[model samples]
Target: MEVETNNNNSYLSVVRRSSRRTSFPTLQGLYVSLFEGEITSDGLDLSISNKNTGKEFNPKLLKITFFLSIFISTVLCLDHGFVSCNLEYIEKSFGVGYAQSSFIGSMVYMGFLIGCLLTGLFLPVLKSKVLLIGSLIFVVFSGIYSSKSLTLTEIYASRFFSGFFQAFSIVYLPLWVEKFSPQSSTTTWLAYQQLFSMVGVFFGYLLGGILTCFTAEDINIYYMSSSEKLSSLFISWRGPFIIQSALIIPIILILIFIPGEILDVGDQEQLSEIEYSKTTGLLVSGVDLRRSTNNNLLPDENNLNKRNSKLRRSSVLLIPSQSNNPNSSKSLEIREICSNPIFMFSTFAVCGVYCFTTCTLFWLNQYFVEVIKVDRITSVFSVACIYLSGPTLGVYIGGITGDLINDYHPNGFGFILTLCTIFSFIGFITSMVVAQTHPYISFFWGMIIILFFLTSTLPMSLIVIMKSVSSKTRQLASAIAQFSFNFVGFLLSPVIIGIIMDIIEYFPFGALKRRYNPIEVGIKIMLYISLPTFFFYSLATLCSYFNCLISPKITQKKIIIANQIDIPKQLFIK
Candidate 1:
């Protein structure tokens, strides 16, 4: 018998000669194929024997899980958009000033920040589904409680819990999605997940608008007296909470349908490896291979003696690699992340961006009503249009561009974000100029145009943060970005904007006095504050480029790992 064992050889053909007859067998293959025992052939049909042990790939199961997780998570995001839009109505209902009323929205974000921090710490210990279900339950109860709140404190408390639950949904849901998806498709799946989230935002706004409009009309239609109508309209704000609560029931039921087996990340990884092995006609299961080392292989006697000496010499680099180790290098990584100059700068940028965005949105409705003298319906519609255009289209566009840039070139995503920031500055400047010199129509239209581009940065910032940070640290990264951006805005918005308005009110000097209209003054302050966003983005772009150059060692390590796992061509075939 003749046997061939060479990497470059295309086929392995064996011929056996016995006293009675000659036998031949052919095995066509690529790459390595480990086999045991001898083969004999007699110029006839050859039978090749091999054991099969591995998991099967189920594409259908993957798709179903991805879709359901995204849908459920997006429901919470929708609620966020709805609550943000209804802040004005909420303020009027509770008889609070704009600053205090802004708390209703800001409190929710605060809760979200806390939830994200907690979830990130606890996720590895807790099952993903348990966290998701727990969050959903919190949301349902919060939504129901919010509808019944009579006092501002009670409302704020409900919103805080609602925000907390929403935060859990945001952080954990994507992690769950990433757990199930193939590595090659991780970015694509994440992008689609974000796309659905934007859709949820669109729907949330639509639902909030619909509820507010109908409730207002119903109040007018049912109550003949003006005072009675006003009283009835006051209660209309609760309608959205009720509707949103009702919408969540079906989502809960859908969550139940998702298979629990698919939710385990470790199990999925093992299964993926097993499936790859099986498809390539391998006889060894990945799990078995892992076990074989521990179960059957004995430590070399000489190697065992040398282990102590090696341990002493390599103790500096031999630290335990367990993911849960509190004292592990990951802690150092976290410290490094915290100390990162780019991260600090980006946090400030995020704060500035969110503050301006939130402040503008919060005040625009009132501005339309009081200064521009537009009807409530027109103001609401205009405000909705401004928000709706960016998040809906801009998020998807941003996510796609981010993925494309990351895939093709290092730091390209940062360039895209910088461009977005530049556009935001341009938009803000144009809006300010228009507000100063143009007619109400010109001002309104110009502001709308500017707001569209300004809001586009929301998604761009999200993508930028995701690109800059590693996957393991993304939760904290997102939390820091969201918290700093939002908290600064929350703290400064009411005070700074209030002070600006107060200045315009008390001073009334030269150009400032001439533009003493509260709405115009608000717009002017927004315009001035918005200039920093451009500066920050410019800084981010430069930082990202430098970080990329300085981080060559990390990139080189990843490339080395990638090359080592060349992903055998035979494994890819049927």
Candidate 2:
């Protein structure tokens, strides 16, 4: 049971140990496993194909988790879509201005940032399944409360709780989905995760628009006169919140039945049941197969003793490797993630993309109503529907391209992301200029162009970041990235634009005497945010290029731990 290494080679070798050491023993920083790929002495390749695996494992669980992850992700973003879609309605009901309305959207993201940070503290100590369910329950209550809120303050409180719970789901969903997915298709699963999130955005808008139309009819105001004020006293914005709350029911129930922790091959009890032939080899006639094989292989006692002694020295692991301590886990992971320029820059790129996306979704419908002179219902429906097409195609296109490119080159994701950013920037300029055209022309062509480019960044950035780090740090890698995107981009974009719109009005007494059209200048300024995203994404690609340039340095420092091993302090993975 020894790892065979050619002394002539400077790199570490991956070899099979005898049956005695097949199961990895957890020590600290060296037991990273559950990922499907071979780590050659040269490097860790994310593209390694495990063909026999498809034939070996059941397809049913993968399908279940795949759809489940998507559904859950959609549920998480519903609040964003629902609230943003009805921002105009919400403001009318409470008699609030653009800045105050922006706070309505920002509150949810405020919850998101706090929740993400909270996970960084508690995820290591809590069971992810339990945490996910608890978060959903919290979401259910928070949403129902929002539906009943009579004031903006009450709604803000409700939205914060909703975002907080939603963050836990974000933290839990990716890791759980990855754990339950086939090793060969981890990136694909993650891609679909983002795809379904976009689906939530669409549904949020659809449900919000539909509810608005239905409730408007109830109050006998299908389309108010242009001269009349928005009468939210009669119109029901409550329906969308209620509908969003209702959607969580199915996600929670489906997740309840999801299969328990995936049993690994290293686990003795599960391994015995799955590998009948291997167990038979070990227990036949009560004889120890490994011992018998070792006796036959070794010439004498001295040789066996020397081999065992070498393994004992080389494999001994120190407990609670300093890197694995609970108190330091988050700080260490964050530090490691920040230090990697590719991860750091790609994360910023991701944040910029989200900022552009949320601002567009929040403003586009209102923009059409104001600038293009489109009808309220038509504007809402068109904007939401147009927004839907890009993400549906973008996620699939970006994800598939990334997976394919990674097969040939390690930096393919960064390359694809950079391209996406560049294209989206072009789309943004086109959309801004085309606003002078017919509303239908801009809605059908310009909106789709801009959205498709912007939405593609998420799945690509996600896959690239996950691949850049070790498995030990994947959760925090994802969490930190989400934190960045949500905090700076998602949380602030609406408020930033809203504040700009407010500044344009210049109410010395902080009163808004106007409607949506007055903010067209602010909307135009927000369009420029995509420009910075291009710079960040291009820099991410540059970092990735250098990452590949120093491939030998990277590989030489690489260590892939398949099983846990005890060792001295001097024996870190590097």
Candidate 3:
């Protein structure tokens, strides 16, 4: 049996190398390889297996879960995009100015911050599925409430709760991907998750744009009060929320009916030693294949000495080893995560990226309508196209690139991040500086370029942060990341931009204020203020790369732990 196992191992290694070459270069092949996890295009072995049982689990369950995850992400993101694009309508409906209307956006993040706090508190006590179900229920209710909201206060409350519940999906969905996805493909899967999120945003903008086109130019011009606004025959701004509520109902049903035993992200120990099996292709259940490697167990004295030397060098480069015990106190886990330099830097990088995105998406529609002199439909649709062509597609590209680079050399992922951030910074500055004098079409294309680089950093940043922590701390880590990114991006960016605009509008320029359009000048200045964030993003990724130099072991262990694989004692070199 031992001899046969060794032979199978050698055969698998040879297949892995050859499979890369034989793999079809088409997008269809990649898609089939990702979800179906089968031998694709004659050579790529994408199927997952069980090392102990020497069998593959049915792909049906995985397919359902994967698509379902994507569905939930996409649907939730629609609400965000809808609200963002419809901010002008919302402002008129509520009879509020830019500063007040900005709350509609910031309030969601406030709710998100609170949700993250509660999720961190309850995560250990409840199953993730239970939390997810509870969150979805609230999300549905919030959507319904948002559509029916008559008062500015009601809109604020609804959006806040909507944002609050969304935190659960944001934090746990990626964890679900981590649980069921193949280790080798986790980055790609996450990128897909983000890609769909951007897609949902685009569609949300599309929905809002389509609805806005039908709205009367003076739809809410005569309505002064909340009751009067609600009394109108049809309120276009509320359409997306109503539609979102209806869509969520069926999703809730699907989630409820899906077997908990299959979908639940429970304790990792309850799972078998899961890892990427060379023979099985991508994912394998119920086995530790750490010792399957030739480098770990060579009997020859020369090979043994060489392996030991490698281990010694690796040990020096690793930081203080993380506590693997899952039962460790939440406070301790939080402290460790907060103190980790890599996690902190990655969070900063994500913060900068998300902040830029939030500001652009939430405010650009209004900026286009009021400043660029474009009609409402054009502004909304143009923003939609930017989202679709830029971040939506960029995230997918980043994920694929990151995984391929990591496969080539682990250090390569860091370089990818650094280069992406630099491009983003340059693109942002060029776009904002040039938009003043360029044609709107030119400005639109510039935005697409800027967002492409800006959002491509997300998947890579997420990968870095996830790799920086232990399995026991991942949920908490995700919660912190959720809180951090949204707080900076969603909660602060809009409000800051809004406040700055108000300040500029009200500033005692006397005669000069009439000469310049305050809205135009304010937007330009606000965007420039935000430009430094991209520079910081570049700085953080650079710092993360240097941090990785002394901690490559942590990277390897975390990747294994991410797949729910327990390291065997024998696999460790003495």
TM-score of each: 0.66, 0.73, 0.76
Ranking by TM-score: 3, 2, 1
Q: Write the per-residue lDDT of candidate 1 for residues 1-574, one digit (tens) a residue.
A: 1112123322211122111111111111110011111122323212221111133447897787777777775676666566656666665666555556666767777787777677666665566667776788889899888776767778789988988887767776555544455533445566677667656755766566566765543321322466544444334666567667777888777767776555543233233334333321211100011101122233344543443243222101001111333467457446545655555665666677666656666676678777778877777777666666644455565555655554443323446556666776776677567657535567666665665565556545655455444333555565566556546864456446755665665563555657567556776676666677767776766765554343332222211112212121121100
TM-score winner between candidates 1 and 3? 3
Clashing pairs in 3: 48-283, 49-284
Regions of model 1 farther than 4 Å from truth: 1-57, 78-88, 177-203, 213-235, 264-331, 410-441, 444-448, 451-461, 489-515, 547-574
Candidate 2 local distance difference test against the native:
0.61
C-alpha root-mean-square deviation, each candidate: 14.3, 10.0, 9.6
lDDT of each: 0.53, 0.61, 0.63
Candidates 1 and 3, the one with greater lDDT: 3
Residue lDDT tens for model 3, 1-574: 0111232333211122111111111111111111111221122122223221243445797778789889899999887787777776777766777777787868988999999888766755677777888899899899888877767778899999999898888877887776677647878999999999888888887887787677643444444456545533244767788778778888888888777655555554233223322112221110112233443333444543453453343321112223334576566667767766556766776787777677788778777887778987788788888879988767878898778765654422356557567766776776576556547877788778777877777787777677556554676788898899888877887877777666656668655457666556655654564366566666656654554443333323322222313232112212
Query: What TM-score would you give candidate 1 relative to the actual structure?
Result: 0.66
Clashes of each: 5, 9, 2
What is the Cα-based lDDT of residue 203 in candidate 1?
70
